[model samples]
Target: MIPLKDNIPSRRFPLVTLTLIIINTLVWLFERSLGPSMENLIFAFGVTPADLFQYGLVSQLFFMTTAMFMHGGWMHFLGNMLYLWIFGDNVEDRMGKFRFLIFYLITGYIATLAHVLSDPTSTSPLIGASGAIAGVLGGYFVLFPHAKVLTLIPIFIFIQIIHIPALYFLGFWFLLQIFNQTFQGAQSVAFLAHIGGFAAGALLVKFFQKYRY
Candidate 1:
């Protein structure tokens, strides 16, 4: 299911979200410019579990932030940026630009930490902004549970668009992450990080609602 858009109206322009998207895009472009040396770029910026385990906490902290902007490929960046565009405005509306920016970074850092804890011995470099954007989705769903989302459903050669409630879409996604973590044990994506971001967003959104209002 590809989420096209959500129904929530933002009170302010999402400058912070736009800025983050631009920054991520530039960083990705810089990585691509290096061509074959992208391996060093990825290692330098992306989170490595073994490095975190051996080198104490500095590498962990640095990568926790950098990893959010360093995506693996085109599809990875597209999916994450799409979700961020869809849900980030509502969150930025509620939290305002500055606080929302802080919220995003905090949840992202927490999410990366969750990934690191999940596989401390693995050498795979964790990358992408999905965890942070997953947090935005989590917070947005709480605020606008009944909002309709335009989604594209692709079934092999067949494809169609459908409107679905925010709750149904995000709830099913959360459940799928849980199921994956339980059965597959973090093979493909960072399911635990997604869950962590979701939980952090849900809790932090509630905490910041009064400030927003």
Candidate 2:
């Protein structure tokens, strides 16, 4: 299920969310321009669990943060940005710009750590904003459970648009992550990070919103 939009509208401009999207887009374009050198960039910035554990957290902090802004491919980049565009604004509206930014980064960092812990011996570089965007989805789930998400569901040969409540949509998404993590073993994607980020976001959003109230 791909979320197209949500029923909730932002009371204020989602400046941080748009800025993040622009930055990710520009970074992606720069990565494209690098040609064969893109692999080097991903290795340098992306979080590799083995490298992270060996080097220690203090030294690997930069990579942990940079990894969130990096993406493995066009689909990876676009998919993350799409979810952020759909759900981030409402979360941002609820938490305010600064809090939302901090929330995003914190949840992302936690997500990366979760991935690292899940497979400490793995050597592949972990990159993308899905974990962070998953946090935004988590926040949306708690803050706007009643909001309807316009989603595109492809049923083999047919495409259908459905209005799914935020609660059910996000709940299903989280469950899917758990199911993937349990059955799929190790793959290119970090399903644990998504679970960790969503759990963190759902847990911390209320605390962040307390400042607003």
Candidate 3:
């Protein structure tokens, strides 16, 4: 099921979330402008466990933070932005602007660390905001478990729209990430990062959020 939107409306404008999306979009555009240099950029900005360990502390921190804003392709960027657009606003609303922004970066760092720990020797550059968005999902899951999400589910030739509770939707998503990471092993996608982000989000949201239940 693909979530289109959620029932919980933001009490205030999601400044941080919108800003992040704009930044991601602008960065993606700049990356495309690089053409041949894009690969080098991703490698330089992206997080690789080997590179993180090899680099100095400052460089490692740079990669960890910048990696969240980079994406591999249009679909990658759109998919991550879509989730952030939907779930992020409500989370931002609950956590307050400044706290939500910091929370996002921290969870993203945690997510990257999770990936690095899972495959310390892998040299592949891990790009995209999937892990960070997964963190948003985690926090949203905690703060808005009962919120309804309008989702699109494709069945063969037909498309069905379903209203799903955040609990079940996020729960299934987290489980799927874990399952894929366990079964798929090493692949292009960082399933471990997603799981890590989601887990971190769920746990961190409690401390970050102002409202309860």
TM-scores of all predicted structures: 0.92, 0.96, 0.95
lDDT of each: 0.85, 0.91, 0.89
What lDDT score goes with residue 100 in model 2?
95
Arrange candidates by lDDT, descending: 2, 3, 1
Cα RMSD, each candidate: 1.8, 1.3, 1.5
Q: Residue 209 of candidate 2: its Cα lDDT?
A: 82
How many clashes in each candidate? 0, 0, 0
Q: For candidate 2, report its TM-score.
A: 0.96
Ranking by TM-score: 2, 3, 1
Instruction: State the lDDT of candidate 2 residue by residue for 83-154, as single tens digits.
Output: 999999889998889999999999998898899998899898999998888888888888999999999999
Number of the predicted model whose lDDT against the real structure is largest: 2
209 in model 2: Cα distance from truth in Å?
Answer: 1.0
Candidate with the larger TM-score of 1 and 2 = 2
Candidate 3 per-residue C-alpha lDDT over 77-144 given as tens digits, one digit per residue, 9 for 90 to 100: 88899999999999999889998988898888888888888878889988889988999999999888
Judged by whole-model lDDT over C-alpha atoms, candidate 3 comes out at 0.89
TM-score of 3: 0.95
Model 2 misplaced stretches (Cα beyond 4 Å):
210-213
